[model samples]
Target chain A: MARVQLENVTKRYDDVTAVEDVSMEIEDGEFVTFVGPSGCGKSTTMETVAGLTKPTEGRVYIGDDDVTTLAPKDRGVAMVFQNIALFPHMDVYDNISFGLRLRTFSDDEIRKRVEQAAEIVQLEGMLDRMPDEMSGGQRQRVAIARAIVRNPDVFLMDEPLANLDAKLRVHMRTELQRLHRELETTIIYVTHDQAEAMTMSDRIAILDGGELQQIAPPLTCYNEPTNRFVAGFIGSPSMNFLEGELIEGGLRTENFDVELDPGAVPGVGVGDDVTLGVRPEDVHLAEHADSLADHTAHIEARTDVLEPMGDEVFVYLLLAEEVQGSMEEDPASSPNQLLMSVTPDTEIHEDQAVDVVLDRSKVHLFETATGDALVHGLTDRSDQESGPTATEAE
Target chain B: MSDRHRTDGGETRTDVLTESHEAELDRGPFQRWVDDSIKNPQKVYRAMFYVAAIFFLVTTLFPFYWLLMVALTPEGQLQDIIFTPNGFNPGAFVEVFQTIPFHWYVFNSFVIATASTIVVLIIGSLAGYAFGRLEFPGKVPLLLLVLVISFFPPAAFFIPLNDLFNTSFFFLEPITGDGTLYNTPGAMVLPLSAIFMPLAIFILTTFYSQIPEGLEDAARVEGTTRLGALFRVIIPLSAPGVATAGVLTFIAVYNEFFFSFLMTDGQPESWAPLLEGIIAYQGQYEVLYHLMAAASIIGVIPVAILVIVAQEKIVSGLTAGALKE
Candidate 1:
């Protein structure tokens, strides 16, 4: 297994910079996902590491060797694509043995390895069946078997489970994790689905506008995002933002005035414009405010929408809509009203008036103009007052 | 729709069948048929489809029947040829094999059509792969130019081609150093391959493009070079397109009469394609219509057999795109 490093990697196509100065270090045998929206350079960064695309600048290192100029075949890496690209003319056995045959392995070794890979993917007794004779999941297993037989140092999967049906995608996601654990090979996966990234990765590197936004564990990125974007992107239903100007107490927007103890947060905050960020799960209803008593800020609001998600309910609370309408409207301010998430059993309904509490220990504050997190650990939830671990906040 | 009287599981099975029968009895015979048609339109559609198909089939096969009737008629009895043949003279087809070294011309057509078809498939697939997959400086304009050339009338190139064959270097000419490639089987093969290449390339490029772009990339990442991936994956997947191109090129080359007639200099003994040889039956003094019809029928037998053998290859069951399901 090999550790991969990209130092100041940048890729450009004509005038457009697809990947801009992305530098990440992935430990050996670790599963790291480069997750982002489409066109966010996650695939481009993976391609650069795979030697499919040369970086316009900087170097790519795999196990201490420079692979920036080498062909993809010489990199000792195997890739699985979103569309399971099994050879249509070849049967399962032939497809799996393709890499071994290409490397010119002996007949005995090829057969042994093919059987081993088939057993790993649970594809026994189907070796002689052509690709068209099998189901979609079976074809993808052959694709995985093809990669498995190669026994490469690193595996690069670009949305390998994107084409599967929803139920099958989840099943294969768990299967991939188990495979990685058993094989102990370094895997660099790229996906646009944040949920997959969060569930399957040891560490996730979130990208936006061709820039690496944050690189941390999924929970770390979720609880403490480095900036406004990471906070909103990492969590389900996304984190909510209450935009306002920083004042003597805390952040003062059109309708709500959140009070913050001065000694609780470092750096001068008066007259500095800021935005209050909190996740949907952190918002508490009045009946559920028992655990949020310490420094919670309570606000009375009218519920506008209720989305029942079986396990939990997303209640969109409208607070001071007439007051928010008085200011020159901003797009980020559209979510100015809070979206409080509660357990499905909670007695919440649309158009119901209730008092919602913002968990003071779970609140985040960011610069209004720059979208950078200005004050992390403002509430000292861990009681260490350590602030965010490093410059990345998480 | 109710199963309230059901007690045991075995009785439930019989009750379900009886209920379906009662449901069927609820509608009139025509209404039941219409309801079945609504549920599955394919069976009804096939009935009307075969009727139309048979009508067109008869319109096409009637000419072959007329050819057989005239070929069996007695010599020069023009009036009775269509109405009645002299007898079931099965020996008349032997004249087509005897006249003007017909076997040699048949062999020439076979060699030229088969060789030209092989050459066309090779050149077409290579060019098709490049056109469909690769990015080059002037790919679009070059493909457009090939398409435009395919539209050009074949007869329009006779003058320049005839001069180029008879007057250019020996590379263009035969080894005899006469600078004339006339009446050589290789002469017809070259022009036929050139004439049929554009359509073959078009068909193949379309087929290759429909395949997902991920196959090559996946192969490359799995440790195969681009060209290696093409041979191992892409070319094998393009078998249907190759067969289509080969069959079409073979048929067009087989039926070619203009250039085949032009280069042979009217000497059927030295050089003639099947089409030109059929035309040779009309002599300078009197036209032998009966012999010509007999030769025409014999000439198509080889290609008809080719169709029967290659018919299944034209239907593709490729599964590359199904991986995304």
Candidate 2:
């Protein structure tokens, strides 16, 4: 097992910079995931770490050995490509045994290690089968087996589970978690799926536009994202942002006013514009006026589309002016519109006006022009005041 | 009662007519036959195809059959409209051999053709691989030059080549000595090699380009040197293409006659022009019909077998991954 560090590593292809000044540290025996959208340089970062591509500038160190100049084989790393690049000419056993044979291992040793890897991936029965004979899931398992047989210090996988079906991907995710626990090797996995990053990573590194946005544990990242990009990228149905102003009484919108913590609004005077961020689950339906009074803002909106998701009902609401136009015209943007996750037992109908109370405690504030979060002292906040933990959100 | 009965009678008559029409449709012999033919048309088409193919084959082979008949006819029995030979004599074969060293001539031709083919394959594959895979300065221009050279007529280089071979080295004439490649097999092999090299290189470069770049990457990651990867991975995967190049080169070398005819001076003892003597010019007097036919037939066999053995490679090489599964 090795700890990998990229010291301001950069990669350039002629004039286009594929990865720009990316720097992160992956601890020994840790499962770190590099997550981003397509063309965001996540795969480039992983390949740079594996020494498949030389960084144009900066250095890469794995366990104190500078590997920036080393070849992929000499770097002591194994990679599983997204295509599951199993040698089609070789059978399952031979594919697993290839690296071992390259290193000149004894036949008996190669056989033992190949079998052990096959057993780990539950591919014992497929040893004699060629790559073409195997299913996509089985081919991926063989690829994993090929990586495992080497017993390298670091295992790099480039979207290895992408080719499998949904159910198979989930099953393999659990298997991978178990494998990590048993083998205790440093794994740097690259994927575009945020859920995979959250579920599988010991620490997640989110990248965008060839730049490292944030690197932290899944819970820490979800609760206290460093910037606007991280906050919008991590959550499902993402955090909703409403452009408004910080006025004399509290956070003020054209239709409603919200109460804010004085400390949360520090250095902010009247007429300062900001965007208020809130998750759908945090907004509650206020049934009575007494309950509505506790909230800084209560606005009545008509439910245009109700999506019952078993545990919660996602009511798509429309404000007064927006309701007159059919729900088709900007359905999500009713003038006083809000999405509320309520008890499934609560009966709600389409075109019926209902009051929604926005929770001030869970709402986030961001700079209107820069899109950066307004609050700076999240490190000092207690666990309860932070956004929902990763587990709770999952 | 009268209206109901009348309607019932009319309905029964229409039903009877409809039933008869439906039955006629079911029992239509011509329609049934057409449907069956549509379902499995290969059976009928296959027989007709074979008959047509046989007719074409006979039409093409008739001239050769007639030539063989003339060759086998006795010296005195040379006449038109002979259904069958009165008797077959071995005199023509003996006279053909007695007139010249026929076996030596055959050996010389084999040596020249075989040597030319071997040289072409080696030089061509290397040039082809370089052109196909490597990035170097002037690659595009060089490729265009090669293609242009391939279009140059082979006979255009004969006089200059003959002069160069016959002349002594300008400065080293006293020590290295003057020697002429004229009247030697080198004359034929060397010039023919040059003539066929461009075509060989062109065919091979196209073939080599179709191999996947991923295999090379994998090999590099597995600690293979560039040369090692080329030999171990690329060459094995591209066996069919290489075989195709070899087959084409062999065929071209074997059939080449112009350079051999000009350089070897119609000498039966030399490697090339010997086949001409045995087939067309026997001591500048007469054509040995039987021996010439036999030798021509024998000469084509090796090429035919080579094509048959390497048919898969040639086909795949020419197509170059178009129909890859």
Candidate 3:
């Protein structure tokens, strides 16, 4: 296994820049995922690393060797496609050994390797079965087997589990983690799902509009995002934000004013425009907030909608009456209108009036003009809870 | 077309979704096709569909029915009774063979059509794959050129093709007769393949383009070049399309008459496709209806057999992309 590094990699298609100045390092034996929305150039970056698409600028390295202009086959990487790209005409045996046969390996050697790969994917007794005859999950395994048989220095998988059913997707996620542990190969997976990235990768590189937003451990990006985009993108149901102007003691909005730690967000005085962000889990009921954290804001809110998600309920609270004036009005500007996540045991109902507080230690402050975060949270901030470890989650 | 191609490829895939559910795929064709979504199809709609289908089928098959009836009926009964079971005469079939070298014409047609079909398939699939997958400059224009070629009427090029074959009366002065294709199988085979190449390319290109692009990318990552990926993955998966192209090209080349008539000296002693042989029944003033009908029936046998053999492939090929996306 070799470390894969892309230095200032940029790819352009005529006038459109698909990927711009993307530089990242994937440590050997590390499972790093590239997570982004569509057209964010995450896949283009991976394609550049795979040598499938030539980078308009920059260099690619595997281990200590520069392989910038190498063909995909020569780059020592195997890719599992977004769609399990198994040859429908070929049986599992032929599909797995395609690369081996292409390299002109001996029949005995090919057979031995194919068997070994089939064992790795647990595809025994399936060698003679055509792709059409297999299930979606089995087809995916065959696709994986095709990649692993090559035993390349790096494995590139482009949303490989996206096509599987939800339950199967989760099952395969754990299987992939197990495979990564067993094989100890450098794997760079690209996906649009934040859950997959947080659960599977040692680190995740978040991209947007063809540019890298933040690249760090999943927990680090979750706890402390570099910019507004990262803060908004990294969490489920997304981190809620309330736009307001900075006042003498705190952030001032149309309705309630949230108390802020002045020292926490430095270089910002009264009348300065700012955005306040708090995670759903951080917005607790006033009584619960008092017990959990010290120094919080008390806001009178009407529960608009409550979504029960098994263990916890997502409660959408409207802090300002005018904010719900019309659906056409800017929804983002609805002051103090926050989505709070509470345990299922917590008594909450729709249209119920309740006093909720934003946990003082969990508030993130960003400059309104620039979407850059000036303050991540209160003190001794550790956001590891949001990013569950691979094993703990599975 | 690309938007249609963009549908989730996995949706069309019948690969195992679950053990018990997909196991049903191995049970029987009728059961598999009658999946839960379509198990209780609307009766009214199904009936209407069958009615429309039968109507079209009858309209398409009427000509062949008429040809068979005319060929089987005795020439003496042509004006009165169209068909009579016991009165059916096999004499015209033998008379047609005696009237013109029918077997030799059949043999000639097979040779020329087979040659043209083979050439079209090779050139068509190659060019089709290139146009479908490769990103080269002027690719759109080149594809448009192929489409334009397919649209050109055979009659529009008849005179020009005759001049090229040196068969026009003006070229028969014997001093400037340089066209080598005249009075040869090459004359018919070459033009037939050229005209059919566009259609073959169109069919093959569309089929190739429908395969998930990732398959080729996977091949490249799996240590094969683009060319290798095409031969090893794409082409093999497009069997239906190849069969479709082959059958269509064979039929088109087999039925071609204008170019064959213009290029070949139709004495049956000279090279002639079956169509040219059929025309021999029409002398200067009178038309041999019985002989022509018999010849027509004989000419249709090979094509009919080909269609029957490859009917499944043709149907699948035509409808594969229809439901997608």
Give the number of the best model, judged by TM-score. 1
User: Which ten-residue region of model 1 chain A has the weakest summed lDDT?
Assistant: A385-394
DockQ of 2: 0.23
lDDT score at residue B82, model 1, on the 0-100 scale: 59
Write candidate 3's Cα lDDT for B27-121 as tens digits: 56666556633765686468779999999998988777777777777665676534442257778889988876789989888988999999999
CAPRI quality of model 1: acceptable
At residue A102, give the lDDT of candidate 3.
Answer: 81
**Per-model C-alpha RMSD:** 7.4, 7.2, 13.6
Q: Is candidate 1 or candidate 3 better by TM-score?
A: 1
Indicate whether candidate 2 or candidate 3 has the larger lDDT. 3
Off by over 4 Å in 2: A248-250, A253-256, A261-273, A287-296, A323-338, A376-394, B1-146, B156-216, B225-235, B238-240, B259-281, B312-325
lDDT of 2: 0.74
DockQ, structure candidate 3: 0.35
Model 1 accuracy (lDDT, Cα): 0.81
lDDT of 2 by residue, B44-119 (tens): 6987899999999999887667656766776546666356654686565565566566666666777787788889
Which 10 residues in a row give candidate 3 chain B its minimum summed lDDT? B316-325
Could you report the DockQ of all the candidates, in the order they appear? 0.37, 0.23, 0.35
List model 1 lDDT by residue over A18-79, tens digit each: 99999999999999999988999999999998887899998999999999999889998988
Q: Order the numbered candidates by lDDT, best leading.
A: 3, 1, 2
Q: What TM-score does candidate 3 reach?
A: 0.76
Candidate 3 lDDT, A1-394, residue by residue in tens? 9999989999999899999998888899999999999999999999998989999999999999999998898988999998788876668898999999888789999999999999998999999997877888999999999999989999999999998999999999999999999999999999999999999999999999889998899999998988778898899888888888976555677677765534346677778888888888988898776577454657898898888999889988888765563466433335657888999999888888899987767778888788898887653322323223223323
lDDT leader: 3
